[model samples]
Target chain A: MLVTKWVHVPEKAINKPRQIEQDGVKFTQSISPWDLPQQFRFLIDAESLTIEWRYLSDSEPVKRKEFPDGFAVELGKTSSRIYKITVSLSALEKSISVMPTDEAEAATSALIKMKNALAEIENYPNENNKVAMTKTAHWWANLPNKAELLANAM
Target chain B: MLRTSLAVYGWLNWVARGYQRASSYIASSCGFFLLIDTEKSEFLSTRPVITKFVQEIQSNMFILFCLFLFLAVIAHILTKKTSLDVWKEIKFILDRYQEKCFPNNKEKDLHRVTLFRLEKHCLFRRHWSSRNWLNFRGHCRLFSNFLVPVLRSGHINGKSNTFFQVGSDQNYEGVAGLAFRQKSQVAVKNLPDLSSPLMAKVKDRKRLITEYALQTNCKRELIEKWVELGKTVPRSIAATPVEVNGQIWGVLVLDSTSPETLSSESVSDYTVVIAVIGKLLERM
Candidate 1:
């Protein structure tokens, strides 16, 4: 049987910037229509991402927009997805995508580090099956124990 | 001997006086001939007339000054000069085109001469019709800079209507219809691949593309093309879609021989112009 260890994992990114069409979202209800700006509320989940727009009443939604597999999310970094939308009357279609600069950059750097760590782990020794038994040292106090374990194993 | 010397000096003075009178008479006569010849021969077209006129003015300032004053007064009285609306420094451009085409109905005279000259060369009609100007209607002629004749000399001076088929967007057929009418002298090229992902991105964006008119809603063909090094001529080719009530009705296309006139910025810069045209077209 394997042994267990205690560690503290840091907080993750749960909320992200909303990505809409570059022209922004517009709604047209009338026959001879003028473009109307839309106000939206976002609800993102594991399976789908949903956006709801209200007309006159606040409690209920007149329009509900849903996407099943467009977005990919990680803890701190951002990924972009394309969304195609069609206006009902005119059949005017548009595609909107997102580009988040700063967090995306940070996430990219973190991903690079994770990849490098994975490469190092792949080249690690075959002797003690060290990685299988180890956990990330999250505090300074845990460093000595982690080092001692490594020393013993070596 | 002193008496003989005096007589010789007197004779020389008479000869000099006669020579001066002859020279003055010749100069005045030459000036008079040119002013009259301007009506008949191509002598006024070759630019040396200005230099000769200046020389005549220098030789006889008072006569030329009176002539200039009289002409200026006549021009002031007769010329219904188009002013830059609401007092601006832009009075000059309209004046140049006006001067080229007007001033004592000189445009009509020039048109007549050109018709006479190109009698054999006039490939199209009997007289040039301002078809583009007609379609645009009313003071929309103020934006007449965009109407381009396909042939370099397809001026209002040329015979009959130019065969370039300078029509409205109602006749925009598939693939080179306009340029073919121009006999490949000019062409507006639009890519057929609307399905490309890049094309979708472009179409989704709001900006106008100069080279690609059929893509966007604006209707101006790019005329200036690439700005060359030397003299700047006004060209007014651009394309913008006429959007009425948030729907694209048609394209407002501008075509001008002068290439500098139309650009993407031409369409972008003149949103009000396009908007006004769109609203007017909607009303139509």
Candidate 2:
């Protein structure tokens, strides 16, 4: 069975510090959240999953990657932004089978609904969609242990 | 107590009588009474010497009362000035918050500005009178399960003045993680137990983890690594969960090298400040 889930990456994960050597002078620079994509679509099958992501501001072609079986796709480090799928490969390899079938399906459905709601808000900026967006943000912010909880559950 | 007071009073009376007799003898020896009229002198002699002594004591008591009153007034003024200064500092912080966080009535980078304002203005800039606390660090960890240092204030290695840094990720450990887990404020005066034996230290560590509801494997080794890297391991730490819309969005943490620099009572201001930041975050 093909299961799909949409993820909204929190801004914290994308904003990371990197050391840059310019003209032999080393300085730490942070990757801005604006420079990274904050949303992704995870396409999961029985043995592998593909992650598709794109920047919000650009009309560029979406980037896609596939991981073998035993790989997991969930929230990124710091419970925030999701930059890529490979970051958590080693950490989540064993937890993929831990999630029950029914719960995984339920979580996928809820995530799909949330993605739709967010899309609606983007398209129509109406009061109802704004309310829905607020609710979604609230729910997302409160799920602090989303990655670990999902890994354990899976 | 009453009997003791009466005894003291009688002793004073005896001393006063002796003083009076000495004064009378001196006056007689000086022959000062020869110049006065006998009748007037007789009247003066009839006056109780104790009355004069009591009068002198009353005058000294009045002088002491005056001094006490002067001190009381000075103390009152000083206290008033201190309170006024605190209020002024709070107002100044609020003003800075408005200017920095919500420039042009909009927040461009909400988290960065919030953490910067708190670190620069509230925690370090306020009347935090401790030299050891001069290196106070303010950091905000935005995730509950895994603490991530999104922004930090104060000096690290005497460089990197900017508040934005992607520091190492931490699990539910230390004061910040404990605060996140507890959903409230958590503060520890001291962190290490270097004086204890190895076995006792292990037991203490376990007890502390259980007591504070922190994750296993105390972050002391990590702190030691930091120390090796020229970073000071905090002696005191306080963390408060930043709640946005009734859900904890993250945690605001402050650490100092001085023990007892932060406590539950001292962190109330921090809580208020974090709460305000949370409300602002909700708007964002």
Candidate 3:
């Protein structure tokens, strides 16, 4: 069965300071819509390998454009913002399906490592000492089982 | 209706009788000898000759009147039928196009243009119209000075009858259909197909879309600022993607609402419609 996963990585690990690249792809934890201060929910389809971005405040969700293969998203200077690198691709595909048994587990582990890296950055008062600190703090805390939730097989 | 028809027929008959009398006088002027034989002068008198001529004249007049009346009625009926058919065709096109443009009941929320210049110019008021160019130029200047900046920068200050001129040389004039972008957001809650099953499964999708669109706008503004050394103020969504020499300068995002009546397929169908709009903009 085709499976999908979402991983969160810290900005420092993937940014110029640490600058880590794996398999021609860079990873980072960006202040994306997924990290908004408000509580949001998403529905995932493992069979089709898709993520449906929905909101609790609103009635419905929208599809985040298919994640770029070689691009990366990292937290911007502002706590409420995210910066994503533009990546060139052959064609626009709806979903990138992977084997559930091996690939899914690896993706989960990668996301957990990124989440831990972000936690270290969040510990430093200087890194987050900005006008939007409270907003960013809540954003980090709401990642429900941040590690385990990366790739739910169902 | 029946009574009126009978009265008209009676009046026509009376007029025909008068015409017969006039014809008889002319026949008599030629002398009674030519009309009757001298031997049977008493039996074939002036009365019988006059009566025959009068009958012939009346019969001809009656036939001609009936033919003219029939033609007039048929012409009137045909004209009415064709006009109604034309109106139906125009209405169908407008309604279908409106659905594609404003699918979410958002059309209802669209405030009417109070500005005289933008109030849906009549077919008669176009440039092709013989109206004075001085008036058109005056309105264009006024719109540029006041409404253009407000709409482009997303500011909402204006009274009733706000107008904006767009395009190089200010060839197009648009009126403020809504008050402000902030208030306009309230109506944007139901964006037709974006909220449908295909999109609804994603969490925080709407927020992401909104933020993404706004961030892109900000980035464009930042680039414009770098070039001009001034806050590259966007005059309006109309000003986005300003083309010069066949190149796209930026992209503009406009807000719309959901009316709930249109099907999801119609929303995706908008790509075709919007593409046509882009082409028209390029031409402009």
Candidate 4:
């Protein structure tokens, strides 16, 4: 099952808790990847066991990476135009990522997501990883140019 | 006297008709009154009285008509004089503003002559406001999404004030936002009271709206966070969208503490000022 939701974060509320509702479930956390205001679309894939977030302005994924049996989280401060966060899902209960002082809260929230996703995967591991990967690849290939379509509509 | 004379003359005419008939009968029977010529006598006697009465009425009517015409001309002149005086003053200020701000047609740097400085030089606040308490605020259109306030001028309690932050931006919200969205001038003679129960009901129980809730459409919670914002919500607001090169570039907003300060009649004057501003911006 694949579900998508849009999240709009208003400007200048750095310390406020953000609530995200996916499908029928709700996730309450203080997860602010970027300090700047932006709108994002979350693609939640249960079969591939991946959560891909894309920026609305330029339909680009933040980042994507694979981890070993333990979930891997990477955090860095880069001078890129857009901020990026890479998280890998596995059965690991711990995260190995340095948290910057200014973004410690956001980093912690990212780690919490990693642990929660890892726990879920452990409980229900994909029976056929090959099939899931093939489906995910096909889904990515068939993705539309949403940003361009939105601009044209406007 | 005229009425009495008219009554007496009418009675005499009636008697003359009867007398003339009797005289004709007598002249035909006895030939004694034939030399009298009753027909001629009757007409000659009544002609002068009728002509004098007509002249008197005509003279009185002519005098009344002339008097009314004279008063109408005087009233028209007085009205024009007052409006012409205001128009002359407005033109003088606008001319002075252009001369002072852009002397010798020298274009100043945009950064050097900021919107605040432009507003100060414009002198519209002093000219438009009867009480000289009008505030002039300027906003620049940003990316077609936001109206960022570049300059805001006003006082609080008869002292210099710094309330709204300089770079705060708004979307389609206030009278200025309405003007920006509509790409035209918008004037509100009196703003509704947002704190009133009627407004709260209209807002669907959103009672926490800001003091600028009605005037500026700013939220109360946001105002609290900003702290110094919207200490004095204006009672009246007038906004004109400034166009540069046929495209809306920004908005010029004027507000006053008293109701009806900035009215629809003032929108034309503001439009003239905004035209000059647009040209100045183009030069810059």
Candidate 5:
């Protein structure tokens, strides 16, 4: 069975697996092509008709679409499975379709793993922790009830 | 336009006569005409001559002019409306034929629904059928009640040959096949190839020649060379590319049941249809 995930990232960033360490929490981000197997990783920009697909262990991306604009990609009976940590900074939508022959217990275990990973990451603080603090301090300086908060705390 | 408008007006007037009054009026008029016009008219000549000679009161000329106008009005009205009625009947029959050919379409209603996404798509629908398909071009119509489907599916064979089916009929069992090449990608649809195991294969010399000619994009030299070969050996021909919007999409291959089966005019019409289809596919 193949699963599917569509992730939208900043245009400046290349989509790939990455590890980040912040606030005593470890997070990993990754994506697989929606079509074909995981072994065949393709980055398709359909408007320019440019396709870059490569097999595992191959350093060079094979260009296929060739045209300057993008075209629609036909998966031709293949699906994708993706794993990533749930974070506020990035957007992700994932879907999974299991094969008819897949064992129920195996599918459940994979779902559990995904759920645990999401729960762990959701509890972690945002990467830009200083921005929150600076905004709060700036707002407090202009507040009419500023004395009240200090009085209640004291 | 005037004739058409008048015909429509007359029909409206006839229908609005409330059935009761129109029937009685028609019956009474017929009875009066029958009584007066039945006898051999020896008195009619003298009556008309006397009426004609009267200087200030020429009733015969006035009556004759009125009768002429009435006949003209009636003839014009009946002809235009009758043709429209016949055309409506034809459209209904064609729609039914399309429904039967492509039955029970749920999601897209593609067979019936019009897709106005692209100007090219609209142009394709406007020009995609041969004049032979229509039944009323001076009575030279073929397939009076047949629904022709557009080419939407195709297959590329192992030998790099393409076969396609077009027109509403999916099972175009033994029809002329058109083969074209698109950047080395062969797409065959709209017709079944005779050489394929799936269809009825017959040895037709003229058709093969035409197929070769079309594959070569109707080049006169290539066609003449093949014709001079004495029709004994089948020759392999290369397709010349057709350019649209500054790009050479592919070469169009056309074939019919027989070589001279379609006239030059028919071929021209078919070419226009193919060009329209190509533009539609390009947009998609």
Candidate 6:
């Protein structure tokens, strides 16, 4: 029994919700936290080992596009393996074979630590992450056109 | 987005079909009789023919009325029935949102909530169950707007609670107040303590918790009265507490008119979802 009420929208100020449906992928203005990027890592290749940074730079976004919902756990584990192969192959092309599992573990641990750090940012308005939390909350709360409205068939 | 579009289309289709049906009913109920009456008037001098035509029209009209009554009654009966599990339907939407939020992470839907009795004032009842307070506390108004009716009309969703704490001073004052107490200020207060009754039902911990409304042992008289007075449906519910960092925070209640809303699989899923929320709340 949700009744529809008519409210006038200013001709100039009205911002109809934007729907993205053309790129073989569709997402509404609703944003989910998983869509945001977190986790960071650094690595130094040994004297005989070389690092290939482009594996992440070139492929991760493409992979994300392919699976906008994000990787399933099995897919994530597979992604790590795929990235590892590319890293190994690229490094081998330049005469490096040895890789460290430490970076992945560190990245995960860091992600957890980062979530803990950022989770309370809203409580502390003066904190540096407040701006980020504001943006995040704004993103969540600001999905366009929350009004119960849709096309009415006459 | 697709759901919103489909809902609009579905509603439009329903309305259009109803209109078409009404037109057919009018035609059948009146059009044939009118045509017969006009032809009979033209044969006024022919007594035998007029008499035969009148008999034919009378019998046809009688049959038409019977069909109309039967169809209307059957349609009403069908409309009264519900096939939807509201929580499950909602969870599907939540799952979609969850996937979007943590694309790589799979999370559980909340099934079980811990129940604890509050000492002083209870909005609907004293013992309340919760999973997370963030949803009910912060965005309750939004949920109330979007989800209230959706949950209310569910086949098994008549008694769902998504309550948050609103201390005595803030009765009808804050966000939680507007969400839970907005229905009828007087009616919401003084309801039987939901906790004591539910606590008794779940006392053995040995007998698996089933839907309370269906249990012969549970007294839902007050709750049912409250719903009736509020002009809402009766509810059989599953309420759980939200535990964060080993401390109880809030409650989550999922209820339906029928006691059979939460399946075993859904309960498991709910456990996972609630636990995940508990962790998230601990950080907050």
Instruction: Find the candidate with the highest DockQ and give its number.
Output: 6
Measured with C-alpha atoms, the lDDT of residue B164 in candidate 2 is 22
Pairs clashing in candidate 2?
Answer: A10-A80, A10-A81, A98-A154, A99-A153, A99-A154
Candidate 5: true interface contacts recovered:
0.00
Off by over 4 Å in 4: A1-154, B1-144, B152-171, B192-215, B223-230
Each model's lDDT: 0.28, 0.40, 0.30, 0.38, 0.28, 0.31
- Residue-wise C-alpha lDDT for candidate 4, range B1-284, written one tens digit per residue: 22244345556555555554454453354333224343356653668766565445444655645764565454444434342343234334444443443344332221011121112122222211123243333332222234444433211122222222212253344555565544444556455444345643635434434334544544345433333343444556656665544345566655554555455444443333555555555544
User: Can you tell me which runs of candidate 1 are displaced by over 4 Å?
Assistant: A1-66, A70-154, B1-171, B174-236, B276-284
Residue range A1-154, candidate 5, lDDT tens digits: 1222221122112222334332222222221111111221112121111112221112212222111111222211111112111111111122222322121222222223333442444432221112222222233334454334323322
lDDT of 5 by residue, B1-284 (tens): 32344467657656544443454564555444445532355665568654344422332445644764565465555544443453333333334433433345332122321111111111122221224434222221222212122222111110111222222232111112111111111111222122334323334644654554443233323344434542211122111122233233333322222223222222222222333433443443
Model 4 sits at an interface RMSD, in angstroms, of: 19.5
Looking at model 5, what is the TM-score of chain A?
Answer: 0.18
DockQ of 2: 0.02
Q: Order of all candidates by lDDT, from best down to worst?
A: 2, 4, 6, 3, 1, 5
- lDDT (Cα, tens digit) per residue for candidate 1, span B1-284: 22234345446545555554465565566567545543344654566766577455556766755765565454443332222111111112223323433234433322121100111122223222224633433222221212222111223422222222223333322112232211111112232222224434644322333333342222333211212222121223333333443333333333433323333332333334434533443443
Candidate number that wins on DockQ, 1 or 6: 6
Place model 6 in a CAPRI quality band.
Answer: incorrect
Give the winner by lDDT.
2
Q: Model 3: residues >4 Å from true position, as ranges?
A: A1-154, B1-87, B96-170, B175-284
Q: Estimate each model's TM-score.
A: 0.20, 0.27, 0.21, 0.27, 0.18, 0.24
What candidate 2 gets wrong by more than 4 Å, as runs, is A1-154, B1-145, B155-171, B193-217
Chain B, candidate 5: TM-score: 0.23
DockQ list for all candidates:
0.01, 0.02, 0.01, 0.01, 0.02, 0.03
Interface RMSD for each of the candidates = 20.2, 17.2, 18.9, 19.5, 24.7, 18.9
